[model samples]
Target: MRQQNHKNTFLKTIPFTSIFVEALKQSSMWVSSNYIDGNSQFQGKLLLKVDSQWESVQLNLHPEKLYRKGVGSDDYTSYCQLQACFLKKFTHFDPTMPNYRYGIRLQFGQQLSHLLCENSDVFKKWFQFLRRFCIMDKFARKYKVLGKIKQCDPVFGQCLFSCVRVQDAEYHVVKVIDKNVITAGQKQNLYRELSNLRKLSQTQICYIVEVFEDEQSVYILYEYYLGIDLRTYIKESQIYQMAEQSSQGLDEKLVADILYGVLQAIQHMHSKGVFHRDIKMENLFIPEKKRLPFVVLGNFCYSETTDSTQYKKCGTPGFVAPEIFRSKNYTSKVDLFSLGIIFYLLVYGKLPFEGKDQEEILRSNEKCDIDFKFEKKICKKISISGMDLLKGLLNKEPIKRLSAAQALNHHWFIKMGTRNQRNQYLQVQRGKSLSTIIENSVDITQSYYQSNSQLYQSTKEDDKLDRVEKEFIKGSLYDKLLYFNSIQYQPSKIRRIQQST
Candidate 1:
């Protein structure tokens, strides 16, 4: 009788042990739960299972009313939270209970429900697990509607881009902006961008493809381009030319073509009363497989309409115009100044004015101290017209700077060689190695930094002396007399005092 009783006890314990083991495995997979359904007044267990093609959740309790079947986990939105004090009061209030009450909130379109759990640890783990699935589900549903997210593109601010398919045959780029990070100011800027993009009609400019929003984020779809930005392309080309012992850095014709395209785009924007306040090489995209002289201008976050005159100081550090620094009203010529910088970069593969830091660089811009003589040394084959155009664009006075139309009609673009001539000029011959070119460029930059440093120090000393003189002039008569007396009697008085001591 004792042996039979022991056998019965052991057999009863086996089921509980198996259930615990199963729960542990489910938790490891990040989906274990029991919840009370207030609407049905029925308790149920929720289990999520993912396979090669489907992600489904099974609710153990049968309901009197069936809402829908074959619904994927992605269809429901999930949120986890601790039970509020009021909720506990309304429900089962257990003051002696050690564990906290938690719940998973679910939303399917307009429908809402909550799954109540008793354990805090389980709530946290389940919440995290469910939230990830929610995001995954969101993306999966988007794939069905907007095609699949193929790959990630360059990320800017709180926005990211992915290569996405729109139709079965068409691929485009989609910008994802998290609504959680959108501030009031940023929202205004986004509105401006949308307005500006809508007003643009130029083929050279990149326009918005589509705009949509979900609960958590906004999506701005863009037409995809099969190329890198001008900055990356130029840097890569320089590296390649250096490695290949090419006599030329880049084809001047190609450079002219890129400039022409950018100028046209700017002209188009300007014609519409839109000013691209921030224009840099990074904003210009060129084709990866060059069939023609194609370029597209993008990134309109800083762009503004001309009707708004009260402008804040905004732009990339080196590319910003001098008037912007003075807090003065600036015109579209600011873009011209930036264009000049780009022109200089394309020609010489270096910035006209650089410093150890941004402050010094701004000071250099204020002084309009640029080295135009370096062009001949850098590119001996470049024509006088090219240099002249560069000078016109880079002119310090915005009023005197060349407009986009003027630059387009400039002799440099008109007289630039044919494709064959450009190819001939770009042909590789005996030249400096990649290492040698980079070293030379570095040496020049370092020398410029050293010179700027010395000049800065001298200017600082002069300012110090000027300050001393101004202070002396502003001093009271008694203070002035005391200063002079100290200067006159300091050495002799010190000797006499020492002797007395």
Candidate 2:
């Protein structure tokens, strides 16, 4: 009796037709009859209401048939705020719409229908009420699983851990995309990434182990990596300690090995016609335990196939290529440019082109004035051949840049030491521990020279010295001069230099 009274109260609050309410009760499917199709311009469909000319359409709101629903824009930029408000009101409703005009897209199998209501307020109420009947009850019956929320961020949404019974055994590490707020474009991108991951056969790349989805969320089980991202690894390794003390940057051989692994993974992706537009240190993961040169590449949200021709600007600021800024169509070379930036960071412990802000960074990228010389001062141990490879990878002209295949064949990679040599270098790098040096000296001239030397080495390296001499020059002039002075001005070395000149 109390349940019937509650039902009556719900029916009174929602101004919907009895036939619609009966249909919902019968099928356990939700339909919002409160929304009167405001557009009189919609042709071909017969008007359901002669009194108001408001058209009504039958929609099957099943979990398997419904792809996604959103208002105003597919990207959900227009109705995001409105959707958020609706989500707050109706906790079960996963609002994927952008806050703009009142337009809703209902996709059922291959058929798609667009419904435009009067305003945002009406649309919000419509979606909020719809959630009551549109709950994933059928989905709950299909998959019996237990899970817990792992991480939740506003932008990326929640990362949940679930265990599924497969062949009488449980599989863990399943990613659950629950009622967390996310855009429709992001939802589509998730599906696209999953599809692409399924197509890939490479073991080096991160791939989905299993996939399961209900009406409310998506569950993706991916192969796990027991390590930190490259960005954090670089910080923890203290590769920049060389700036203050007599330490060294990352070894050239180790850098080569890492790049080699990255290139192989990229080669596999390219062969599959997929390009990872956003390649950065944050996306690359290195194992905590010694895995030699192997590094896992994750985050395929910004990746695209080679055949895709749309030229919208996307990617992180410093790593974004010049062509993307110019709004010109680009190819897989964009990934190469981004890879070059990562490679430069690995070698120099800093970006090749940097600015105070995003705009400045983009401007620097546009100019493409890479500072190869600065690398010499900070990283004195790097080989000339390595610098040449950096130049090839970082070339502004996409056509001129070395392809992944060509990069693999470069002299630097060709001369790369054996796996044992790389392992030994990694061990040495791990062993060297340096305390963080703070600049406490007040001497103006001494501090000025030190700061200028670091800056001048970074910004004016190419302008001050010729590339040919830079390649041959071993260590710094200070070290060479100290050796010469210790030898009491060796005439034989001076004669050899004069002969060479």
Candidate 3:
């Protein structure tokens, strides 16, 4: 009977392994190895292991190039095949396939345009590739042309050209492309920009997968971050809401750490004169861990270089700074203001300005009519210092608002009581210079999450910061937001005074 039981367990494990391997083979993303010369289709044996169990799989990827003689060719052939290995285990079966259909998506929308705009030639190639790629449409037909643009002879386009997922610690090549292009020069331009960004972010941001350009459109290759976003993290992951909620809950320090890292990235962009006009919870991506929550400032369609304004009114409603709508001219401070709102959400797990419509939210944002008092009441566990920091950051006046640098240096965050001492701890924690702490912190949460409550208290005093802490410890999603809809959102006195003035 013992032997029979053991054999039964082995038999069950075999089916699980078989399902895993088959799912990998049929997955949209499968790693393709074995380099080749031209457009050739090939498959390679891939090994995947979960926990302690191991399984073998296959990868189907092809090397193709958009070659335009005298113009350019894809710099590397196998560049498109690398997909993240984590996704396969989680989302192996197709939604439309038999039985398995579990998957979550993380996308970089407006940000793609901003990243591609750096090189003109590449941008064109990317545009063409976007138009020419065969993507699935509502009709279930694989069509190359999803839409069209009127720039320089009506260009065609699609939503996304390439899709990738991480399954095991490696990338799987899910899709291959047939060549179509505006030019070879454009193709090379895309490759160069992607390569540069990837290289620069290799250590700073590891989750962003490298992009590749084929004949049709520029394909942004990225691994699926198998977790919820900040918005969901705030709503579902509330400690109190765990049982009643459907989403994951997060910790308080984890929320602050993610916010701090996001501020650091925005600060870096400010240093480079790049303004991510779109800053919101949806734009902030959370990793599987709280400390290493991934907040990417995506949707750069409204982003502006220090010297350009051809693009106008390119931001989401609630998060868009008032100046963008009121003043034609704006700067990186706009992104800073939005970051403040995001910080508020991270700490309080609630939107600063709640209204029934876009006009109301915009009016509130423009008027700076956010009620910290109510936030104070709801977040009874937060510290005063943390609340002060949030108040300063969420200030309506861009000038009055905390710059990313200043926010980082706020007395609230000064645990050791001196800039130098605090800077040292921050550097050690971030693994970079004090100024680059934000960048360093971005990658740490993915691998490390150490709670330092006393350190956090000594550093920053946010009265409501404790609410995030409480939520992290024992709050539930429904409990954290139980009052969100019922509570009346009123503007603070300072905001009223400013408006009156």
Candidate 4:
């Protein structure tokens, strides 16, 4: 309620209404610019930037280059010199005269242009349009073309594309689902994911912005987060450090921040009856540069609604909770167990359950026999408080495992207030230093997800029949959503790779 109140208060301060914004988008008037040899009324309109992820609306005198590109490819041109495009710092509005009520000057580095909208209403429309364009569109289809975030896109299913809303210039990522490649069952999974994301979006931790679909595709848009996942960050940053014997793993404070973020995400999920069956380092993000301790927890593929039922087997080998393998009735405690694996790895610099192959790893994980090997390096990376929290989360007994809310209040977390500990953080960064790592493209083919081919090859005929029956039910539920007027969907069931009738 407090958060909602705060949001309402913040929004109330905004000047324009939706009607005013719409008027600005459609309204254009004669505009004069103070450019060298520029006409007092140059051929210009309230122009939306032709090619931009950050949809920018400028009073243009002519079609202008965003800035000079240094003989780089078109991709480079799109992103480079974007700072020059936003003239908000140099913009000011005041009435010089009745005829020239709105005066706007835009300065970019050395370049300068002054534009005027003589009429007051038209000028306000332009002003409001300019102010609001920086806000990303509420819809996914509204995002125009931007460079691909990954070096190579996912081959099939949901392909992730990097995008920006031109108006607000806010970075957004789009997950594109090709309807053709997906079976009706696969389509149902998509809808389930969509439903989960929508409910979870209210948490504010979820950056889901919008969803759009047509006959051929479904696009789920999300606010883009810069940092890589905890797994990638540690592998890239610490593997070499470990070789040099300088650091054992992520420092104590760093781990705290990452875990705090994950805890917050999990807490919200649990409150909403969602249990993330797969919570691991790969799913936990590290906000290395961000002072806030809370890192983003994402990837909802294996998460499901936790009702009173024994869950089927799912999730990655090392991270899946032991009770899940038992196939007994369980609750959201499974997520806490998965989170413990992440906690241990961050401190120990290695997975607790290690094996030569995934099968061996699964066996080790099923036993729930964690070998806590203490070393000087581990001591340096974690403290008694940290260790206690890890132990509480990792307890094999579901009843004994710490709930997300309980975990958040643990002394390990309570010693530091959830908010206002930003200064202790290393530096303020949004994954820019690690941006070069984008070139190190992942092999999409050998991805973490269980491929359709692998599943088919491994399953027996009876297993396939069971899968078909389950999918048919899910597909019918998803089809029901299509008949609805909106995307207010409830996931009829959870993702269960193996289940009993």
Q: What TM-score does each of the candidates earn?
A: 0.52, 0.54, 0.45, 0.53
Of the pair 3 and 4, which is ahead by TM-score? 4
Which parts of model 4 have CA positions greater than 4 angstroms off?
1-141, 151-158, 202-204, 239-250, 286-294, 308-310, 379-381, 416-501
The window of 10 residues in a row where model 4 has the poorest summed lDDT is 489-498
Cα error of candidate 4 at position 277, Å: 1.2
Question: Which tens-of-lDDT digit does each residue in 1-501 have in candidate 3?
Answer: 654664343323111111112222433332233344432233333233324332333323332221111113323222221211111111232233333222211112111000112233433443333222111111112223323222110111333332323233343112222244334543333333232232222112223343333224334444443345556665674643542242333344444556666766776666554566777766665545433544554323244555564435646666777777777766677777777777665555566777899888777767766655552232334444455567666666666666787766553444213224343553344322222333232111212123212222223324324464434223333442343223311124323443555
The TM-score, computed over Cα atoms with residue i paired to residue i, of candidate 1 is: 0.52
Instruction: Measure candidate 3: CA RMSD.
Output: 20.8
lDDT ranking of the models: 1, 2, 4, 3
Q: Give the Å shift of residue 233 in candidate 1.
A: 1.6
240-311: candidate 2 lDDT, tens digit per residue: 674436555456677788887888788888877788888888888775564646788877767777767775
Model 3 is weakest, by summed lDDT over 10 consecutive residues, at 107-116
> TM-score: which candidate is best?
2
